[model samples]
Target: MTRMSSFRMSAWGWLAFALVPLIPLPSVAEGAAAAPVLQGETCSVPGLMDQIRRGLASKSPAYQRYLRALLREAAVTLPGAELQAAFERETDPVMAEHLAAALVARSEREADREAMQVVAKRALEDRDPAVRSATVRAMRRTGALEKTGDLYERLMRDASPEVRMEAATNLVEDNKFVYAGQHGPATDTAVAAAAASSDPKATAKILGTLNTEKLGAEAAGTLQGLLRSDSAEVRRSAALALGGVPAEQMGTAREALVSLYRGERDTGVRKALVQGIAQLGFASAVPELQRLKGIDPGMAPEIDAWIRALETGLQEWELILREKQRLQQAP
Candidate 1:
């Protein structure tokens, strides 16, 4: 019986040993295999171009978007000929626009003046309004419009309001050739059209450009008219722009802003008025700023701060003017 029991135990042990391979065991270092890493030739320019070509040929919209992103990333690093070739081969207007945008982006990033001029000229002829608008912006960024003045004038008259606005903005900010004696009717007309656009954003952009270019006196009449606009945003932008008006035009700008402030109900417009007043250092406005600070609870702290700053600024300005007068009379 003892021998039989021992034999039975040995048989059971053998069966357990045989089943060990069939049962799943906890993963061990030596038993696990590492996943293979993917290797591709995406690092080289030619390889990227190949990818772009393939992506453009694909029917998937997602692939096209990916290609656009890749092109943007490559920018001026890609050969100009390659980009132009791609643009030429592209049949879809939208795809062509994307390719054009990539070229423009490259031009802007590298400050490639020649490339920008070429793209601008081509973009102006493009059937796509978006492409034309983008090219106008690129011209503005690269200051290429300064050289291509006719393009600016032509773009200002574009059928699309968006394109016209872009052209107007570029003309105002980038047209360095339109100097003191040469400010022509074309520029005046473009500015007027931009300021008169139904799109307040476009109008606001023009006003802001006027301020940035320090051409306030040139647009004094437009600024005055804009201050009376029903759109509070237009009025606010006009108020801020008043700060940049030429010294000869400050009085007119100040009067318009103060008059608008008196009847203005919007807190935002009122704040803009304070800023303009502060910019002008109009000491006489202290009383009105104080009054507004008392009544407008939403921006009381801001108004109060402006009041203090204006007071200090006006005092300093007065002292400088008095000293200058005293020195001039010392002869």
Candidate 2:
């Protein structure tokens, strides 16, 4: 499927790492009302909270959700004193500000980290394939590469091509070494060829030097076609590649993707449908995706999730419909 460029640095290798933990954990006053929670020991809730708070302060949406989940956990296990200690000891000034703001908004930090972990783990191990696919996506985004590589490799060899397809797609995107021809030789093919090549590095170097612009339009159209391909691998790659299209030409591929979502029977293709729709911000497809639930109710929760993301996902659709009406009424 589509290739993506991944960050060269580790997730923890951020500016916050330099600033936040560098500050010493604050000591309690001689007559403090209560002692700290797990003083001198590794407390998971605080560590998790710090990670999430730093993420939220950086305005990282991915981390914001992660932090929200962690805050939920803190509300459950940590007393206000413990939270205050962790918050007071935060080294990063910017993060400290955000932590203060969030404290004002929330009444109780109510999250069940243990329960969430169990759900995430079970999803990874679920017999229901769709649940597993969703879990894998969530894990990858949240930087939970703990055992993801091994799990992905195993899934690649699974009897169900669907599972293998989703895992491969996620891995390919996460690795950032895969590229579609739009940017030159597709990374998927290059990775495959390199694995079989005598000199994978040289092949990769050659791939790096290719003229990506040469294949631009062809790559866009190819991505559109691949989204509808019966082969799961092709669909996954296409979905990933679709993300790489130049913004100017994104509109060019809209009609083709809309048609695929309406007619394609493959679940992998439909999954790609959600991605492409989000990327292009094709609000017109909202009604179509909404109707698709009649064809398949299982997509309801996901549709609701996507819709709830930005002011209930309604403003965008309403704006699009209003623009259409304006165009229709114009001369």
Candidate 3:
């Protein structure tokens, strides 16, 4: 027998998976022959909803969870319009939250305009943080690409750290998905739109991907603005991202990176700034890298590696002389 070792859920199925270990599922009558498992059957949405309603009315957490598990299973097979309607009419905010996620995850209508519109409304208007959190997933799953970018930029400043982090992560991850498709322009557009909001995650994603020099006079000006952003994460991300831009694309980025190193307040961000400057592989950065090594002996190894790498890139003749000397000495 093949054993189940792990599972992945793209949507809301985990709700059931979490509870199934604790509660015993309903058993078939012992005297009656067990009904044959049908291969092509789907759960009846209305019938299951009746049971779910009853379970909720029962006011037992266990029973509600049992019903929730059942709903999660049925959500896979439920009609999209019907699921949307169920969500619209659901009275309990928690169940409504789950239903919205399921609606976006299942059926062909996940991308329906009306579906995304309602989910966006709930994400904005709902006072419950949990409901708002779930709606972010629903919004990402159901909303159009441009709209999703816009929503994510707004949510990046959300009061709830969890929601803010989720928005930030999704902004980059969703951009990455466009990259996976090899839709290069789409990725650039998505990141550029959100990056303009000055959110750290989106800014990093955009900076790593765009030829910022092509943004007319914004050129290195955009990067300079980013380094001065109020958010340390944004500044840190900008420093790291600037390292990724090919030097030919913006030679000035190396200067920007090195300039930030001395004044950067956060030790971790300073290290990232050093890493960015190191990645640029400019020999001029060696002096500062050396200064950092002297200031913090703990940074010796990384600093030394950067120094060696920069020396090799900038002074290949030095390596050739050392090699030639070594060969003569070998005799």
Query: In TM-score terms, which candidate is top?
Result: 3
TM match of model 1 to true structure:
0.51
The TM-score values for the models, in the order shown, are: 0.51, 0.32, 0.57
lDDT of 2 by residue, 45-129 (tens): 4565656655665657776654554443334444555554554455443344333323322332233223334323433455656
Give lDDT per model, in order: 0.61, 0.45, 0.57
Each model's Cα RMSD: 19.5, 18.2, 9.8
* Tens digit of per-residue lDDT, candidate 1, span 18-102: 3233433445664576544333232334455455665577899886765665555565556777776676565555555566666
Worst 10 residues of 3 by lDDT: 1-10
How well does model 1 score by local distance difference test? 0.61
- Residue 307 deviation, candidate 2, in Å? 1.8
What does candidate 2 score on TM? 0.32
Q: What digit string (tens of lDDT, one per residue) describes model 3 on residues 1-331?
A: 2221122232224433332334333456543655444233234566556556655788688876555545655565567678877776775666676676665545324444455556666665677766677666544422344544466556655666656555555545555553342444334443444455645655555454432222332434555567887777778766765665544644677778767776667776776777677655567767868877765666676567667656665455345335434543553
